[model samples]
Target: MNRKTLALSAVIGLLAPVLAGCGGSDGGSDGGEAIVVGTTDQYVATEDGPAPLDPAFAYDTGSWNVLRQTIQTLMHVPRGGGAPVPEAASKCGFTDRENESYRCTLREGLKFSGGDPVTVEDVKYSIQRVLDIKDPSGISGLLSNIDTMETNGDYEIVFHLKAPDATFPYKLSTPPAGIVSQKLYEPNKLRDGFEVNGSGPYSFKAEVKGDTVVKAIFTKNPDYKGDLKLRNSKVELRPFKDADDMGKALDSGDIDVMTRAMTPEQVHSMVDNPKEGVQLTEMPGLEIRYLGFDTEAPTAKEKAVRQAMAYTIDRGKLITKVYGGMAEPLYSLIPSSVATHTNSFFNKYGDANPAKAAKLLEEAGITTPVKLTLNYTTDHYGEATAKEFETIREQLNGSRLFDVSIKGAEWSVFRPKQTKREYAVYGMGWFPDFPDPDTYIGPFLDKDNFLNTPYNNPTLRNQLIPQSRREADRSAASKTFAKIQDIIAEDVPVLPLWQGKQYVAARDDITGVEWAVNSSAELLLWELRKGTGTGS
Candidate 1:
């Protein structure tokens, strides 16, 4: 399950003070000008199930950003974890007498973009449908304990879990839990050709497909009652493929913002010093990059081999050289910003010591020149990934305990192979599905776990995951998770390499932008302005 996957509010100070308050600014939209932004289409079109524009079907972050705005959830994370705000629901929670049951009542006047009055049936069906999909998207596994789901009223729905699950609210806060209009989802795919029938502040428009994909427009959902924190009426998402193109776009004034997916060099050059019209800000990301050992492979299953290799590698050099200091070296599965992140692993495996590495191999009953292959995807993270591998190879071989061979695959191809467990060892990067330690640990929860890696920890998978999810309180859940991570560092099925940083550049005109802990590059579209709107 090791797929290799935030903040408090991260802040960025610009060289220029917050743009001056302009008259009739309407979110500082350059005074009545349309605010256009760009990003790349990372996924190419595929015939596979008509491409899951339905967030319920897949939990990719790019998709989550759109879905969270489109659908309604029963309970949500409030501004200060306030009482769950009503959407389709007036308010929802479990009955005191029955801790396992969850319930929500609807708000009035809410309608899907298609104008279907959101109802309890729609909520039940939308949730139940995920189990039917069985790919489970990301929420399926989390929802497995549902013993029953029924609508108590037209606007109210109840879920009876097989066990007490406190994290359920946080789970609902996640986009996959965003309720879909049963009216929009047909049998297996979307009702229309992937166009979202959203209920949020925006509606989907044109989509341009290419190396650099751009979505036409999404204006405020006129019926939006959920969160009006956003300041703009429209949003444009265009992919620049990589940072170089984004940098160029920022420079040429073709795009107003450069956000997300910048490499080390690009970060140094464009983030703070991009061409005119662009403003750059860098923040630590809710992302982590790591190395996974295919325990499914017989040779990799040996704990000694896994441990020895882990001990032998030079992570510091890789971060410094390959990542260009854009990344922070990580010593544990959980990252720095996340609660419960511990340096226990670092306490065990200090900076790379070739002598210690060789000794570890020798003690593990392995002779020098232990040969192995490591795999990575080309163009997935940055140009330096391959170079990172090269640095790793040098470090391992420097210890004279391992002979390393490196291989590269394009992400589209690499994704399937990793899912199939074809590589012996590989580089994996994960963007958190939900901004929680659970999302990080949940993917690699156990083999056949979420990401489908074969690295199963019977104790953690069967015992820990259920144990955590079933807790009556998330604080209690975090307690169990602390022990679970101790187990992770002890086992070392995957090695945590580095924590990534997210960088974004916006048009001086863009506003209402705030950085969440997860590094979502989140913008409440309605919060953006030109001459007539307000960003924050």
Candidate 2:
């Protein structure tokens, strides 16, 4: 999946000094009280079933946040962000020089939250089920490389790949690869509802209204067997309808920390006029917002139409006017932070030019003021999305070459429709599954891509991606990735907009705010605790 950073002084320093002396305390270590964290993220049931909590279908950040706490993968990204390290497994590595065969040995005495032994069979079953179900909206693509799985004795599991895949271990580190009890989950069907049963740092019980998760209360999983140490005994995750509500909860101390969907205005308020006992923690992020196209749709079917709109979109204007300069204008699917990134779009289109847009349309025999619709989710991204689309509507309309109408839907409705390619052009944001350049490009360009778009190029999907995956050294495949980015810019199936930095607004009494959310944008709820300091 193409997932979803910024500079320090220009962004963070403008916000506030990085809070110092904010350390976790032992006071709350004895199960003192539940630490309530507020987020504007919503988890809803989809056509794939009410399996948002199931590792096979928990593709989004909201679901993964809860899963990361309760579910244990064989390998996981470290708290401070680095290469994957063993979590449930004692050790894991490629068993061959070809990077095709991989093996992992489970840690001794590993058990599920239900207190059942976590055998190698459970590990094989968990991954096999994801491939069996293959939910279009789920993360089956990450595990598509697996040709077969073999078990050795009771503690070891081996994955045989379809081809050489150096990134397989990173894929295993994500929540989608989280091990589950085979008894509780079906072999070919997703386990429904909000109940999560895994061996991780915490165990959770959730409250749901309709299909949306309203609240989730996580207690320390005493049966948990993992490398992570829980800083707080309990964490209650409260979901808000919007940033305003979440911010109010933080201001009134209804929640100790507010994360995920804080608006630019709310962040500015916190930065300029700090709350008495609250502080904003900024960290490097790879989250990105972009527009996806249904290549088969009437107006969008034409390559020139897609190219014309790309020429007319002023990303800098969108970032400055809508985001208040809190985000960077992204020109490639690969964000600037990735080593293989290139400014391919900027190199091709230069800047937003209505004249260039008009010329392309005229050459393609298309009429002026081409009519089209732009779709976006109302609640999932943030409150500013409405204004962000409005800014885009104005930009496209201002060009006098296109007639654009913007449509908004709640995520539950938006996600299914977008995946079905119901909209001619839709907006979506990505939080990377792993820290790699492939995570940015592969998901959108591959044949079994998550976007469900029809713009497939053999060179990108069949050739370059596999070529890049074959090389054990990721940096050595930069030229291949550059070619991949060039094809994406030319195809215009998706247009890059802006990349954002992560922010967590927390009360000074809350520590580990910086480490609470990892580089991949997954919430490490176990990292947060009640602090005894004045500074954040």
Candidate 3:
């Protein structure tokens, strides 16, 4: 179930602004060819699925995939990754040193595909509506710092913050703040039906459906204004139930691109064994997999018991035996790729030490063979999750200090229940909303984290977090981040398990595979195109 997730947005001052769609090949001159993309059902968006298409309500990757292309955000994590850049905004800057007031001017002549003019009012409505609707699973929490938004004339929008927040701009670059045409959407409720009215590189054309969505067709938005260029006139998004089917689709040329949820075994079969007209591209290791311990749960409430679990599990074995080395062991909440990430856990525990685990349990007055149940989402993570959890069960039981039982819950039920403190110990995966180190640190430590664990240290919740945000220099913020990681290592609120590598299998004739995955590890279908020649 553990795989890399999605990207986030940002603002403070427009740092390193790149013209959207400025550079990169237009997936080889259109040619009116339709690119068929293959993805597992886990990534396909449906009205009946976990998320709704309304920009304000969609939170999962399936929804994000549709939203990112259809709707333009004020800011974006550039295709190649760096500081957040203005995407829809012609210009943006902070008005105060405390990082409270922010302003943005929309690019002139912005218009939705439906021919509605995009105005500051639409931008203001998009931000305010998210706070108003506040879907429990939505990104409203990211906007908690905003006090109010005011629009001036037709193109200017200003945001007033309740508190100083440097990362507020980054949040602006995500889907939660995607500009929606006020004429097409209601302020207090999610938009009904599949019709999308947006001003991005693509527009919703039609959907091919059966019991579930078989294919979603997107055509280029002729009026779209940005740095992106559509490589093909149309994009056909096809959803498969399994990775094996996705791989087979790519091999048979039924699809031009194969996206997320491909298992390691399926990847090896395509890359190692060789598919005549297929190519596999591996992405940066930016995603994390971790185990959360609910502090309210009896066994987990004991610091010694939590520490013992951290000390006993072998992450190396999980990476090698289970993932086949597609991932690397992680020791801190922030993956090593992030600037402030430190292997604090590894520094303390070294490796799986049975003696240390037993000693810690004895000190806590907890007996050996601690019985506990571990939970994981069956549908959200991937098919490999069951094996992954079984490996965890075996590892803990092998320690002789824990008697572990594994359980599965559907994501629809699992996520809300976990947030409600229903699970004692569980596994979860994180995809960054933005590429900042703070994205990793802040959310998990927030008073109401996803698991809503009862561990809250003032040093982390109040002081370090806000202090890190106030420090304008990211490098200066890292010192506070390092300290927090040290604290998390001691607290054992969650144990970092593994960092994942992105995988994309594409037909050899696809020319833009290199640029298909932007800096944020997002698949840009607009960057893909069909080449005239076949297999090499």
* TM-scores, all models, native as reference: 0.86, 0.94, 0.90
lDDT of predicted model 2: 0.83
lDDT of 2 by residue, 98-198 (tens): 99999999998988888889999999999998889888774798898899999999999999999898888889988879998888998988888888999
Cα lDDT of model 3 by residue, 14-112, tens digit: 221112334664435547878888777443334334335677766666667778878888887766556677888988878999998999989988889
Q: Which candidate, 2 or 3, would have the higher TM-score against the true structure? A: 2
Residue 267 C-alpha lDDT in model 2 = 78
lDDT for each residue of candidate 1 in 323-373, tens digit (9 for 90 to 100): 765788888777776665677567777767667666776777876687889
Q: Each candidate: what lDDT?
A: 0.64, 0.83, 0.76
* The best candidate in terms of lDDT: 2
**Which ranges of candidate 1 are over 4 A from the true structure?**
1-33, 47-52, 78-87, 97-99, 136-139, 187-193, 210-216, 271-275, 366-368, 446-448, 470-479, 515-524, 531-536
- Which regions of candidate 2 deviate over 4 angstroms? 1-31, 46-49, 533-536
- Alpha-carbon shift of residue 239 in model 3 (angstroms): 1.8
